[model samples]
Target: MSVSSHLLFFFSSLGAFNGLLLALFLLLKKDKQYTDNWLAILLILLSVRIGKSVAFYFTPTLDKSILQLGLTACLLIGPCILAYVAQSTLNNLTMKRLTITLSCFTIATVITGILFPYQDYLALWQYWIYRGSSYLWLISLVVASVMYARKNTYKLALSKQLLTQQPVVVLAGSWLIWTAYFTASYTSYIMGALSFSLVLYLTLLLALKSKWQEKASTTQSKYQNNKLSTEQTTRFSNLLNNLIETEQVYLDPQLTLPRLAKRMSATHTQLSQLLNDHYQMNFKQFINTQRITKAKESLKTYPEMPVEEVAERCGFSASSTFYSTFKQQTGMTPNQYRTTEI
Candidate 1:
């Protein structure tokens, strides 16, 4: 085979291999909804490109027909796929609307293409118009994906302090791929098509690598946080247990933190520090969680009791305070919660 033929096969094999790898990854990790959808869409694109490459190798004369078909697919389904991937990744309502819009445009383009098969000058004009629309859609898809990736990175960064740089690197790499492929001067169909395929493959590989690294880092951070959180929880649980079981401090309607601290034989400052630093809760929330927990039990078992009586039994000083705390925590007042019981 000639060098050109050899190069075609090489790109085709590489594209198909990448598609199969992505498909396998998706199948293996079917539980992750976002990654699975992305891999699935990517596999579709790769498969199509591979077929195009193979067709190009076997029949050089049908190159224009093949190019037209490939570009048409790219124009029609490319945006939809990108939009779907963006929506899945970000789970954003805005992206959903964008996906819907792209789907509608794809439908319209298909209808137009079918009505006017490109044989004459007018049909050719119509074809180019639709093709331009597809390019515009592709541009939109690229922009949306970049925006979603940036937003996802920002959210991840805000949630964890250690995850500062991974998102930025992924975003930068993606932008670079887009820039290199789109800004090149070689307007030949083969070069353009190959460049698009190369950029997409590289983008997927980098994205998956960045995502895996981010998840690993996130998992580690979560494990550490959970460990620390559990320790705080245990300490608080012990404190509450002592308050309810041994000292019986909940029986005091006016059980302030200072008084409870005195009864627990710890300084008020030390108790306050425990609530704030370890539990990351203020004294009011700590006391109210205990009160509301007790109130829930009372409401469940003592259905005949008045709401006010339940409030008083839970060591709440007033009915209003009990109602407010209950609503704040459960999104409903005590009476409403009781009414919906079971």
Candidate 2:
């Protein structure tokens, strides 16, 4: 390759390499949430797919199996991105539903690959599989966009807050841009990879910015070094318990730490210290625990009640959140749990 060609190769391939590294970091990170796992999977699949494209664009004679592998990764990217965004927004269908959908897609892809290997059916692979995968990816993006819009319709006015609060929107928009470039005949094949590289660096910058803000907030907060004494801890715990059990304050979907603290006649620092020190949970975690507990009881008692209604009654702002949280806590989706109870 010439000097310019070599530089292009390096630039195009850099993103895939960094993406794989980022995915590995996410996988190895401790105390990962479901959203983290989905994001990791999305990154890994995207890296594989992009890597395949860069290789094929440079070396058209790449092995057929390698081509097949890349296309399969491409096919999976649609579902992976959908799941990642959905999980991030807490607006996903049940995990079981997602699993079944993915399994069906995998089975179909495998069967087709076996029946007509890419080497034997190059045209078929080039046309049908390529188009199908691209369409699926577009469909996933459309669906995810609609879901996010519905979830954050009210927050759209505050662009800064939207970027910080829904980083997934920025990521999804980046993915959309890459997809458009990849599918457009006017754009060079390497342009897609370059777009991905740009987005990956943007993601890194956003992540670092968030971390810095968090560190700055902690440094500024008076409660950073605040701790409850044993007696104060006991007293605060009793107050929290009474607020939750007696008042059932967790039923309010709009509840916040400050609001709850005010209600409990305690300062935010005291309430935060109580939850963190005594329960080993943050404010949101503690509140979600109470809500999940209530959901479990409601699920068992009123098996006839719709799961959505149960979720609302138990204080979840969205049924998707309820489904994900209940499964996380109870090892079953609401419907699955209901079936077992029956």
Candidate 1 — what's its lDDT?
0.58
Compared with the true structure, what per-residue lDDT tens digits does model 2 show for residues 115-224?
99999998988898888888888888777778667655544564654565434544565465456556668867778777778788876787789779656655655645
Please, what are the lDDT tens digits per residue for candidate 1 over residues 156-253?
44343222333343333334433433454454324434544575566666667757965674465444433325555576558767777665566445
For all candidates, the clash counts are 0, 0
Which window of ten consecutive residues has the lowest lDDT sum in model 1? 160-169
- Candidate 2, residue 325: the lDDT equals 87
- For model 2, the local distance difference test gives 0.77
